[model samples]
Target chain A: MTREPDSHYSSGNEAVIGWDIGGANLKAVRLSREGLQVVQQPFAVWQRRDELAEALARIAAELGPAPCAAVTITAELSDAFRTKRDGITFILDALQSALPETELKIFGLDGKFHHPAKAYQQPMLVAAANWLATALLVARDLADCLLVDIGSTTTDITPIGGGKVLAEGRNDPERLVRGELLYTGASRTPICALVQRVPLWGGWCPVAAELFATTQDAHLLLGHLPAEQCASPSADGRPATPEYALERLARVVCADTELLSQAEVQAIAQYIANEQIHQIAGAMTQVLSRVKVVGPVAAVGAGAFLAEAAAARLGLDYLRPATLARGAASVAAPAVAVALLLNEEACV
Target chain B: MTREPDSHYSSGNEAVIGWDIGGANLKAVRLSREGLQVVQQPFAVWQRRDELAEALARIAAELGPAPCAAVTITAELSDAFRTKRDGITFILDALQSALPETELKIFGLDGKFHHPAKAYQQPMLVAAANWLATALLVARDLADCLLVDIGSTTTDITPIGGGKVLAEGRNDPERLVRGELLYTGASRTPICALVQRVPLWGGWCPVAAELFATTQDAHLLLGHLPAEQCASPSADGRPATPEYALERLARVVCADTELLSQAEVQAIAQYIANEQIHQIAGAMTQVLSRVKVVGPVAAVGAGAFLAEAAAARLGLDYLRPATLARGAASVAAPAVAVALLLNEEACV
Candidate 1:
């Protein structure tokens, strides 16, 4: 769906657009003097990476033309391509093909933008830098805060202090080890990956190793996510309804509705949700202990509620990205952040 | 490929065919006065469960019909069906349709064969009982021993003592929690699931959560599995060759062949193989500590070499399933075991 920016952020500066291309979704934000406009689409790049240029062309057309475009990418980590270099080069080529006239600047982990040629030369710099873009925008408002941006497939826990991004890791692999990046998220994570054993029948019941269900089922059953937010496909190829969700969850324990009562299935769902929170909180605790950032946690992305809950568990104050980028832009924080950064630089 | 049993175990009784229907493959063994014969085919029941009857029919024609048919199944645990009951009922129906004239008996955890109608009533008893079938066969030869069966997708560690099966858990869920069932195997398991971080560049680099490479690639590259033994499809659908396996393994760390030397990629393979052995040994330690069995480890299945290594690490002597069932029948131990059991019962 297309989300037009509010008229308040409109200034008499040249229009710019930002793109946060991820493995599962494509998010774009247009910041013009008329206001900020945001558009996000669920694109399974791994399956249809060949058509990425067409998908981008459609979104670019809807968002209209701009003189310059700012881009940050985590799609390079998708298994669709062999390496980050292949993914980065393919995405940059798609962007160029889709928006041939625009001056494209690739966002890097150093919190700066580079030419597409430079991005191709050193792809790791542009690989998975979407978190840094959002952190840069958050740092402008709050000098010392933990930025927790949880998207559909991953979570980024970056520490911001002294109006600078205090991230110990510069890339995804390093970030994962340092507890600055968590593979768990709101919707796309396989439920089996989150918990090896779930509570059932007053005992610990191990789950099937297969991808029988996903976190989308857990969050949907628990009402943590609205129906529209479950953009990913269900594990069973069924609709994202509560009944099918319960059916999918039942398979996790090698049981079915005939064996497990609705209440029993709902309890499993609750356990799964609780386990997700527990894991996210554990990672946050690790990061907080290491970074020693004593400030409110600014939660962003579509899974901001999960981040906020994680923050509460650690007895830390919580802030919203809306304090900086209001409305739908908050959910598409990385895209909006890059647009704003490029806009400010253009104005200068 | 169809594997005919050698003429060594021929006896004067009505022939009985045993079947072990797993999620990833179908195995069948026939025992008669003429001899014993074994045939295993890679049939992804999860993807084409409807064609199970057809696949069984083709195999049955090759092995010839028997007076009675015995069956033990783990295919019902596949996500292709909603629950174990569904998987059990579907597989039973396939067997009935494929061998309409043969008397069909379902093998259960109790080490006995029940009528198909009775099996439907007690589905869990018949679900995932293949390991039990093999254990019963082992108990006849070695009264006190640990049964380690490592297949394409899972490993089962069942302890037998006093010529009796002493299993603490009968079902997959319980077995998983008790350390008797390890979801990791020599092949089919995603490398990311075996270890979250792999040793790379003299440091631990976290792997991408996607199914970029599987244990099949690691085993195939390290020569643990011959190309012919890799019956399952590769992660990238590439041919089961060392060169392609290396390419797939490189992607485990978000690198490519150009970025990593062949030696570096081989090191990752060695690490994955070691971690798998370490995990199996850890589980064996848990089982031994609880059950207090001082016997040797009887390793079987397509991944028997892996089980042998794990057994050695725990300071236990190793035995082969061939001690009980000779030739190709050892690799298809459960199938051969059930066929022999049914043949003995029918003769009486």
Candidate 2:
């Protein structure tokens, strides 16, 4: 694993924070003379978008204050807003209102931070740029590598070569076509989205196309994720424990624990987890085939373990998120990347 | 079209009602001296299972009380209950409370009706027996055929041969394996469940796994269903119109109308509609390969048109629901079947 260089936050410049405001999560990282401080919160933007400003205010209060903050966002893709332009404007408005004293810089697809006004005029350039932020940060260190950042709901397989981000798709739609974005993730993806049928009771049982269970349940049951780290809400609105997850997972095949033994449910979980890994691996292979100078895969985020599994399946070496960010900040790599990038600018 | 025999409701017997209680719909039909009275209501059982008793009572009040009510239910498959037994018990309790003076007979997989106690003891027998109720009714007329009943959220493909319900699988799980129960429906199924990617902007773009849109939007936009018939809630909580449907369809690819033209959105809807038909057709082929004496395909329910399309695609003769029931009764075939079957038993 390649370790990141020391903090670029010089003592002479005031500390600047970074925020990656996603549809389902809010990640904030503050870089100062002391060290890196991270705050991660789960906020359902699509359901409770009206509460975003208040949530942002609460995060701002917890992180104290900074003179400026750099922001990369995927929240613009949330269905709460009619269009990304509207989402970008709403988020920028909320950011300004929540952090009235701090200046805000919006990270764009071009790997540059622009003033809020410029972002408003060219919202598409800044929409869903969180992946770019992490990729740009990884590009700074690795001359050639693939950054496989798997979040709660989506995976970003960004390729970096020659110390530059070489992503062919600039937008989500294009990225999806190029296999750079695989919608299935470790937590939020519905089990039915991964596979239509699961091997059960000596037969392949078709799964219910409902949100009966998510990858969180499968991962939680299979020990890929702990109870605490199962951040997404249970599909059945039950507790996030393995017992409840097993019930939810059983329902994916329209059965309950009463009908299915624990061993059977565990097998189902294992199958789902394996299929999820295979899905990521398939996408990674498609991505790797296109990029020149294939390097080690940098697995990062809440689903970094899934990325590593995918990397292993492809017989490729993998790097942990700690190679780029430390501790919880590694899971919040985009937030840390923006903070570090902003800090470097301040020093320059 | 093979027409069904005249109603066997001998005026001597007291009026009988039949209820097909589904997870998303409550379809009630009354067979009295004055012909058939059908009532269909949308009730989200998974979200509000506790209100089921009240809903049943309200429907009873609307249809008026009967001496006896024969019921077939698919609501037991809802995740609201821990097990099918629990669901059956709860539904029976609701029925008893809703009609204290009425005699209740539960439809079973044995092509017979049993007392509520029998259903409670062997809930699996009556868990999803609505399909059987319809099949038995069709079996009375057609000696050999496939009963393709496509509701809002699921499609049941039951084969009947030699005037018997020759279904390979009894319950939902088993039926799924035998290609007798397809989870895809006409309206409520999430679009992502149908296909992982859609042809968009000269490329195949991955669809968002989120419930941003459903089959209702595709069928609505494609004119397969009228706006008033879109009983399911819109995925974006927008109006059930082609305009808003286009918006929702675009979001499946993480784009909006701003990025996608109406023609493009319509193309996407067309693709989804065609794929849904292909899915049913594929299942129909798998099912047909197993059964002997393959006969006409009787298309019924809200998605009878879809079933008809599937039948045509397989180059098989198709019969409309009207072949067995009339008017709206065709859409509420299960309810109508239970009513006719119970009425016949009453006459005997």
Candidate 3:
């Protein structure tokens, strides 16, 4: 579950660990003089919230306890807490527990870093702010570029120009309206949310609005994601095997294996995948039209292929975050960015 | 508090009590040869789910317990239960405890009544199915009509033609996509849901997507609902008074009375109300266009005003359910419908 440090990892000196704690996953990056050491764990926080401190301890152990920690979180949006404030406080408390002696800085929505006390005061800023860190890092590399970070449950499309994050939205709803934020993501999104109708045998059929299948199922069937990670059904509470995924997708159209063959299911997945791409492409177009700079789009996240497809569809130049940085750092860009920012500030 | 029944002089010879158990309110009707006697109590089931048996017992005591009881429920959709099945079983258990000796007939979505065990077998049919009973009752009287039943949290639009219920959707999601169901309701629906844009001094401004005010506030500000009833903050979590409602509504637009006068706030409320009507009116138009029979629209539920306005907009005859039946029965049509059905079935 943990990727140990490579040979290039610097000694404990000038070392910083970054954390992107989400509802379903805990990702960490340790940035040293040599390179980025990343660790990812599939932790459904809601199910085992009490074990958060323990999970953090495990990730921290992987990084070998860096001098300072830079943490950003979206897990506060989960229902484990009554309010965002509670989620933020709980997450911060866990971070404090994970690194009791180390200096910790939390990334805020205002594009600044804050101490735990200050971050706790403005819980909204500290909550779900990993996107800002990634955008900030991307802005550093390419002053004029579009940052497309699509994860499991959401998408962040930020315009970076003149070494500044040109974002019209500060909060989730505002971002959603301004096309800087999209609720649709590559994985965990229910297939019903992608399209109203699906192309069946020869005609278009209206889809059943049930949680029978998700975008993960579509992407899995299409071989976009590794079969092992194709569909981690933390919420679906079902086996995440391809056979089970087939059954789940078939049920979406009110069919079963007996009625629908694998080819038919694959066709459904393709139609769904195409619609999802169109969704992101539409949002990308909106943001692209509003901006004055003709910058290339930077595709990032576990769902980076979506951004690549979207940029290609728009006939815009595409830049991979992995090309700009290491694959682990690119996939876990926010964590790496925050860690770099912290390291640079400490050196200053 | 349970409202005691008046002495309309119906001894127990042919009396039958019908129940409509919603998540927030419990409405009951005692039907006899004289008339339909209704009693209502505000019982928040989610707050104290275990007290459901006790709450039902109190309500049944108000009606003095008839020999036969017919029940329809929408509370199964509440979050008190793990699933609709669990909710149905819990509700059935509560009803059994409340009326242990009474011959019970539970209304099912299949347009028929079933015994407790039979109804439990088909939990989905028993869940949020009070509307079907009312629609079926209305269908018997007026074969061709569009039924608009709006409650505190949701609305149901059913098409009745050829003396049968004609619906494009059966469940909530299906009904939602088919336009037969709308999550927007009279009392508890957040104002932000009604309209995205609201009238400012001269221009339309997007309202803050916050739960500052609900539809109850708009209705209260317009003087449609009485002040006593207007201030029912059971679910709204704020004082429902005109003065308080004004403050709450002002918050929706991120304004205050000093900055945006009472007239402006009133306009906002009016704008929201108009948009809500337009929403239902639009749905009515969609359903009306598909049906061949040109029938009068039956307006029921507390939000019947919206239906009346919708009927006026469509230039169709508006028939008040209250006029067709008792005043209380019309207001709580599902309970009345079930009571009538129970009374008829008792004779058989």
Candidate 4:
């Protein structure tokens, strides 16, 4: 892997922070002119929305004092349409309330920061920034690359060309319904809504209304989702455990087995694993159809199953960031790519 | 085929009307002493809730002057918890308002009609009536059977025992989440939420967010959902067509293959078909697991593909009712079975 150029510590003390607010977990990293440094303590915003402000305050306290902070928020608080704007507003408001002294910049699709100097309303820019960061950090040769960031509630498949992220779709509901927003995500996705049928030993089986298992359980069983990730919060703030995952999965389809026999549950888990892999692969193919990329695809997400499955299915080389970066780098490729682009543009 | 007893239709005025309010279609059968005359009109209520009430009013006007009517509301319109009682009340009020002079009795799961004379609610009475009608007029010798009804938004799988419908699972959302409600249906089901991956030529593929197609299109292409069924009124009162079905199906997965080659579109259609068949088969297996039945499975719905796929996968005999009476007959079988038991108990 090519190492990033030595950090050029700018005179400005302003720092940029990227936050990935998912349905199950909240991840944030702090980056300065020096580079990314873990804030030491990360905030956990699970089911309790009321605690969000407090959590951000705690995170802010750990970050000490900074001149300015950039925040990007994405979560599965509700259906796509219901939560998108509100979720962003909530996070921004909370951050502003918590760190009142810092120069707060809320990032949208626009690459420009939402601050006093630059009034940027472009959502694609922020999306591109995230995408760019991911590409630069992971795929150094960002040109002709497709960056897929699969999260809990949705997936973002972006094409990179000429060292710039291409934004073909909107991240909103109407666009989401129109194929702009990839709906299939890793956590909290209803299984019944996934595969219509699960092939059994003798015949096919249909899922019941009950939540039998979630993709989390399937990934856990396959050892794709690690214990650390599993222990994170669910869509609601509740701690996500193997038991919770199993209980949710068990409810996917109603069966007599209250606590499914290990074999039976495993069968469902395997089915989900196969389906998830299939979905990720299908998305990769779609991205490939649009852009002619020279190198292997790059994936950045907490969902290891998604990345691994896509890599294996496409028979392409894949890379995961060695260590999580602060700010946007938590998402890897996009964060790094965005940072690189910003740095180059600044130099020019 | 067993003939109905002469006494079954001896009374010229003894007739009962069965109304099934499904998410996609509204089916009404007037079983008078003169025989069953079925009037089936399809309507889409996904976006238009008022149209549902108007459609029911029109049906009531057409069935005017009937002594009594048994209406079953099965759709997303009525939440079991909040609107179960209110839903029944609304339907009865509508029916009463339409048929001012006729005596209309609303049917509830409790088995007893809500009338001034009844002190206790006999929930199983409706099941008994449905069972009696089926056994008396349709399946005479079939003792144990599974009734699968695939509607627009949901599927109902009822098990029959000793001529009575087994009442074990709750038909509402609570029980639905527990196993009673299977949310997968034939049409209008969002596709993006279905499978994680699609099968490409050699490997699996992930689905994009574009509205591609739905199970409705799959069934239509596969010749399972009939042209007549496909012609149901959309929410806008426009007649549905093959192109519309394709559009709807594509919308499920957020795929718009109108620009795609026929071969490519066909492949996507096939993938949807595979998922739908799998879903139906899975649900069928769930019902089969709970009850030990010897006879073939009986399916009645607009989704012929689901029934055929389920039957073929399970190696069970599949029976389709010739007319709309199939639903009434299916429900009647268990009703009759229980009635027989009640009769035997009374005699003892």
Candidate 5:
């Protein structure tokens, strides 16, 4: 991973799509001369690699027409490709193929944008480096603060100080060792993984070892997440309603309405949520242990609730990324951040 | 919830298929006057209600031909039907349509064999009654013992004494309360649901909430399960290899090989397995709290290892049904048990 000087951080004017693509899903933000739009879509790349171009076309269609695009991807780590180089080459080829003759640029680990040919040459600089875009953007707003972005399937934690990215590890594996990354998230997590035992009939009972319930169920039951925000193809392939969530959570302990009361299931959901908060907090603590918080912690991504809870537990101030990007935009912060950066580059 | 006496347990002679139909899968055993055969197949009844008839026919064909059939069902609990009665009627109709003029007898909760007419009149008695068939067959060998049958997605623990089923809870709700049943299993169960945090590099980390891995992975890594023993639609839809398992289990802690070593993931798997056993043991202890174990515990089902571990933890003698049925036959103990009973009745 390389760090670059900001001498080229100038301004130009045009529309740009800041794309943050990952193994299981895709997120993007379109910033035109008119305005900006942030979007997130689920795309199981490993299951169907061919449809990715179609998905991008659809997302772009939703964002309206654009002649310029900048991309940062984590999807390269997916087993669909043989190596990081293969993944980056494939992604670049996808962009070149889908938007021929369009001005396409890739975000590099060195903090600059590159044409596809150049980006492909240093694949390591472009492999799964989207988080840096968000961190770099956050550094512009606040110095000496921790950033937590929890998506549906994973969480990214990074530290920035003195208007600079200070992450010890710029790569996924390094971030994990330093506690700046965790795989847990707000949704899609099976509840059984959060805790072994749950309160049942006045005693703690072990949860079932099935995909009967997920973090989405817990969040839905607790009223922290809206129905529309729930992941489709839910844990049970049923609607992510509180009722269905109750059914799902009950299965964690191997029960149904016939066997467990709604109240008992509710208790189990609460227990899971608490354990999840603690899990996130543990990672956050590991990252923030050395540095004392002087200001609010930035909470971005779909699972901001977990970050908020972790910050509270640590007695650190918590700031929602939505305060700057707003609802859907915050959910797709990295994409939006890149879009903003690209727009700035265009303005010059 | 009813128990039948031996007066109706007469002998006859014919080939019989003992069918245990569940909401998501089917387990069947064909018992001829001479020998026995056990089989299992996945059938998501809810997703394809109309295909139930075809599924049964296919399963029967796999077992060759049968002159008579004794059926025990749990598929009624599936939402495919509005009520247990509807599920029973649907299943019976499917059986009749698939096997015209074939002698069909349904196992009622009362422990008596009922003609379709009688079984249809009160569907509740015939719903999810396979457990009784297994317990009754076990009673023939050890009247005073606990039957722990761990399947792919559930575990059934029943108490038998004095040559009769002594479970206080006849229905699912009652059974859940008495710790006589658990939804945890050995293969299909998601590993995340088994534990909140797994032991890792000198510490504990929350397992990935995704379907990144399953108990099958732990067992695979530990060498207790063969690759062939893995479920077809694996927890992550990947090959059931130790290497892939490492990738899956590492995700539990949100790490990849980059951040974690192979040794670390192996530890995580071992930790998950231990926690899963403890979970089963906890439930087992709750159920046996009020009883004195005078004989060996009957350990059956796909997850019998978990039950066996729990039994060893509790200092009880654990008996593998394979000792009585052997190999795959033990995996389908309930199916085999009912088939044996059906063959005896067919002889009479």
Candidate 6:
């Protein structure tokens, strides 16, 4: 989800912890009714389930005793053989065990927040939580619109019609190969799959099979993707560097590049940048075709490079959660949007 | 390269051999000038390039010696790599040795044929051979056209502008990753990468990570992809089905279904078909954005299933090469178009 500005809440100063479980990172935002505060910590979902729970507990502890907590889990946490329901159950159980006293609202697809008792009635609660949050934030204006939320591992293109998230297809990897899931993402996407040729100064080049570069490296070089986002390690928890990106991307194919110069690697980076632009543009076009979205296109996630490029290509106004959620540095725009929606609903 | 009718060459007796050397298959076609008598063959391009050569030789013996050979070497034989060039050279040398006194010309991108004296310029030669055949058939009419050749492993979207092939990127796998080469193809492409979800009767499903289905299976079931074009085991050294096309396609994905019910397999096939359509649509849109072509799209290669689907979706005219080649059953329309173009240039 895209980063958003922190807004002050003045109602009850009781702290509420918001958790954004992503494929690669577990981002948490602790807020009280008074204002937003920073909880400086890093959480990796790639850790063991129990270890991850402990990390979440530590974050919760930092927030002190919170009266309520809203948690959303997202990631490639399960193997191919496992079902989403099973995966969701495992994560929810872990969250409950770690933070017992606080009232827990697990998100699901029914467009309602429910406790463990009602979990069986609805599926995709974790996925729906984020969508619900997104929906709640923009409900007034987005009666009939397409919500394109690009994250590190996958892009969620949900068509929102009549203030609800229009269900398209499953938003996971297996479904990814089926058309509903687009595999390209911001952080950890394989670069080899993006482009087929690299353009050199003189002419185009066929990239050698070696881990040459990635979309991150290309965006970093192109200045389209920010270094801050690139600062984070890959989904696999590998550090990001030009050398590492190149090394991983080169592995997409087999090439003898041990003796090759750095210039060749740079050329591959340029090619990847161009291809990323192309793919982002294509995906944006697909989203546009499915829904009749006009004017402003809400861009979210760490993939600002793609968002900016898509904005230019589609000739639409772009809204980034990062810009809107400026002061509230702790809460991402998607999380904030969700919180705001839930708050509004709580009052009603 | 969509198929065009055989109006250029009327000579009924003379036959020409067309060979497509790929990473997985050696596809060859022998056709009469009038396109009447035709013989098509395929050989598995597994390990052991020497065995591949022997397999081709056997096919040649079955088809008998032709007046001339028009060869288009893709993948490892496209002279893109040192090993590929050496392999092609070995195969051509063997062909010459097996059938003496016949003129053997290796195709290149220079739009010209070369003898052994100029064999060092193999890369340019292969491109020229492909272009020579392609250029001659269409000539002035080829401008502003995108030649989409979808084989087993990858697809080539070459733009023809100003009566010349637009040389933008390398026609190999490494360069292909750079976006200059689109990896999605008709046969043998991994299904896991197609789509992430499949819509079932109840809800959208995330495909399991096990050997399930492939694009080949989808196309075959849809009846848009012809079974005759599929590779199979044959006594006469021609392309024959390995067994059931469905079984081969099932091997492309990792879905546990050794004893899967027919309904289950069909569901997987449906998902694959959906993914193929999405990919083809996306790729076609990319080509349309890059170039402006006025004429009908010429769809060629084994993956015509995608091309046809793309054409239908885009509301564009679809030209099938086989329909144009008429009597030339062996040489697909796109290949025939290339061959006719080469023949015309030879006469000129």
**Which structure among the candidates has the greatest DockQ?**
2
Q: Residue A173 of model 4: what lDDT?
A: 30
* Candidate 3 CAPRI level: incorrect
Error of 6 at B256 (Å): 12
Per-residue alpha-carbon lDDT of candidate 5 for residues A134-169, written as tens digits (9 for 90 to 100):
888888888767888988877888888888887776
Q: What is the TM-score of chain A in candidate 2?
A: 0.95
The candidate, 2 or 6, that scores higher on TM-score is 2
Question: Better model by DockQ, 1 or 5?
Answer: 1
Which candidate should be chosen as best, given lDDT against the real structure? 2
Scoring the B chain of model 6 against the true B chain gives a TM-score of 0.74
TM-score of 1: 0.89
Which ten contiguous residues of candidate 1 chain A have the minimum total lDDT?
A: A321-330
Clashing pairs in model 2, backbone N/Cα/C closer than 3 A: none
Q: Which residue ranges in model 4 land beyond 4 Å of their true spot?
A: A1-14, A22-24, A32-52, A75-77, A80-91, A108-110, A116-129, A136-144, A170-181, A209-211, A232-253, A256-260, A321-348, B1-154, B157-348
Q: What range of 10 consecutive residues in model 3 chain A has the weakest lDDT sum?
A: A229-238
Measured by TM-score, the strongest candidate is: 2
lDDT for each residue of candidate 1 in B200-290, tens digit (9 for 90 to 100) = 7677666665677889999999999988878778777778889889988987766677767999899999999999899889888878878
iRMS, model 1 (angstroms)? 2.8
Candidate 1 chain B, which ten residues in sequence have the lowest lDDT sum? B321-330
True contacts kept of each: 0.28, 0.64, 0.00, 0.06, 0.31, 0.04
TM-score of chain B of 1: 0.96
Which model, 2 or 4, shows the larger DockQ?
Answer: 2
lDDT score for residue B306 of model 3: 79
lDDT of 4 by residue, B1-348 (tens): 112322332224455555655445566655555554445565644335566667777876675445555554543232221222333344445455555655544344554444411212332222112322333323444456666666565666666667666535543333343233466667655454455555443444445332234455656655666666554333212335655554444334333333233455566667877876776677667666767766666675555447667788878787764322343333222222222222222111
* Candidate 3 lDDT over residue span A103-143, tens digit each: 88999998778889998888877877888888888887788
Candidate 1 — what's its lDDT?
0.83
In angstroms, the error of model 1 at A114 is: 3.7
Quick one: ranking by lDDT, best first?
2, 1, 5, 3, 6, 4
Q: Please rank every candidate by DockQ, starting with the best.
A: 2, 1, 5, 3, 4, 6
User: Which wins on DockQ, candidate 3 or candidate 5?
Assistant: 5
